[model samples]
Target: MDIRVKFLGGAKSVTGSKYLITVNDFHVLIDCGLFQGLKQLRLRNWDDLPVNPEKIDCIVLTHAHIDHSGYIPLLYKNGFGGKVHCTEPTLELADILLTDSAKLQEEEAEFANRKGYSKHNPAKPLYTVRDAIEALNILEAHPFDLTFRIHNQIEVRFFHAGHILGAASIELIIYSSQGIKRMVFSGDLGPMHNPLHFAPVKPPNADVLFMESTYGARRHKDVDLEKELRQLILESDKKGGCILIPAFSVGRTQLVLYYIWKIFQNMKSRPVYIDSPMAISVTHLYKSFSNYHRLESDSEFGHHIFDAPFVHYVTEQSKSKVLNTIKDRAIIISASGMATGGRVLHHLFHRLPREQDIVLFTGFLPEGTRGRDIANGEKLVKIFGEEVMINAKIHVLDGFSAHADQDELVEWSGHISEPPKMTFLIHGEKEQAEVLRERLIGRGWNVTIPDYLETFTLFDHV
Candidate 1:
């Protein structure tokens, strides 16, 4: 028996997380994420995988985030027909995210074709809504901490990862002739002190580990989250302009809403508009899964923390467009946290030119994304095929990021009683991963920062 691993994606990059584990003839994929951010990375989504889709026996997802689970539909469309397993909440959230991703692609393709701005003769989406729906049918949900079998030689279990509703750290128990080998995959870890979700659960001892390094090089700003948010709100109000926050629909949107509601209780509050239908749906899920998060059952507002009276859920496209008419004193939250795509682009197209408006990014922005360009003080950004001036005051509140920072990541890794024989730093930019690699090496752990398409032999002649 032999065991090997391949990094199809999410090795040196922060997005598109796919890892293939091969034990003899059986192959299991850890994640099937789509490449995001830069044009170079996005183009990888269109390329054929080095391994055939049908050759993959099963898929085990860590969470439902687009970058971790977005490529399922494309793989399924290509010929892969196997169960995609995840926790119950992850299964539900994946359904929502994947469907939304498909709709956005289809809408963008059609709009590009109509406007004749796309280089492709007639722009086409990577996968259709139909494909996403078909892929979803194969999803099987499991409970956290419960071990389940995918193959005769392989068993899997999940632990709470604390980033989002159904996020998890995966542990694979492989039975080989040499002995039982344990492997752990750290899905994106959340901050230890997050108010929305519990702290990440530590993994059991492992022989091999794959860890995320999204914030490995930097520590999050040590500011009072509520105080800073209130200050920003007050400042934006004084300027008499709306605060446009580009946040992820799942985790960041809900956290922003919770804080806004808490702060608005005593102050003169602005009309808070949640402009993404997907976000609204996800907010409701937070209400449904009480066991998954740290939110109180009943808030000052009412039974649901997300049910503040000042909040407006805009589901209609016409209503979303109408938000552009409001020049001042409103708080609008939209999706595609990095401003890579989605309705947030339309919101930015209108608000970026307004000097009084505030564009607040609630989390990390990947390199080559529009959010990064705007946050880096790039004066002009191309949106909807036209260059838009960026006069709006931009602020990045890393305190709102769900990903654990450098110290917290080290603290999480410290929980392991015995060091793994090998650890691979993944899901981060090159610099961030390198920083983490050095930090771990200093602790006397064997660490490697794998490159894209890199493969390793974990066990041979077992």
Candidate 2:
């Protein structure tokens, strides 16, 4: 029994989320995600594939989040013809996200070529949108909570992660001559009371577990996020200020709009503009699978918060410029949540330096992102290759975070069915990971924080 688990990404830093496992000659790559953040992390995507894609037997995804699924187009482009397994909702979301990501890369490359900013003479995209579409055609859908065999010796199953619409925590069982080897990969854990989704299921018993520690170190603020959303919109409208919120296109955007709908339920009038074209379409995709959401059928919430009026879809440069004339009295929710890319950059260029306007951050901003800099109170910043002074009244409501808090993680894992032999923490900063490790150890679990690219043998009886 030779089982080697390699932490390719998402170990120490929170960006790229790749992990590879090998049992004899059978190769399985858990994720082949893009490394996002500063240039150092982003450069990893440009390098050659870590392993020969042809030799990999299968690729299983935990969820559709870009850090976990971004590089699928690149994988397919690099000659990985294997089956990619995920839930049905995850497949739909990935279909939207991967195509959009490839298009964005092409757009970026074109922009770079025009502006002469890129080192490449004619700036080529990492992978084209066609590559993403090709990858999408090969997707294999598997339902949650069902155990299915992949090979003679390996079985794979997924449990609902409750993090987003179709998130999951993966469990793998490999039969060896000595005994059975069980491993669990806990994807991004959702909060206890997520606005639209149900709480995640209990962790299953296993010999090894890979858990995320994104929110390990801190506790979120106790505030009714709905109330806060109402107040923010009212105050900004009264002051004739355009409120800008940079949000992720998928789960975070949907949650924010749900709160927006909550506020509008009481308001008499308002003009809200959802600028990102990707978000508008993704919102529709979200509705197509609305049955997967807990709140879609809830009596207390409207079924179509995404279809609210005053929400204009902005895609082209000309249409986006129309927002400039929008009299500083409307709400604008744009994308590239971390202020990293997308149309949000143009919005921030104007809004950030305006004292009357407001910029609201809703998602987790990693260390090197522009969103983190603004949230942390950096005075002057760069946008679209120009330095701009910070004048917008930046408001960061800590309650808007999407991940589960420290107590939630502990409480959820503490009451699992079977205790794990060893736990490895990933997708967290050092401070957060270390604190969570100590706290988990206090509860009497064998926890190991694996270093980046660390390798560990699963069975001792090899």
Best-fitting candidate, scored by TM-score: 1
Task: Work out the TM-score per prediction.
Answer: 0.98, 0.96
The lDDT per prediction is 0.92, 0.83
For model 2, how does the per-residue alpha-carbon lDDT over 379-459 read when each residue is reduced to its tens digit? 988875679999999988767676888888888787666668778888887788899999999988888888777899876
Q: In model 2, what are the clashing residue pairs, if there are any?
A: none
lDDT by residue for model 1 (211-260), tens: 99999899988978889999999999889899999999999999898889
The prediction achieving the highest lDDT against the true structure is 1
- For model 1, the stretches where C-alpha displacement exceeds 4 angstroms are 299-303
Worst 10-residue lDDT window for candidate 1 reads 296-305
What is the alpha-carbon lDDT for the whole of candidate 2? Answer: 0.83
Please report the TM-score between candidate 1 and the true structure: 0.98
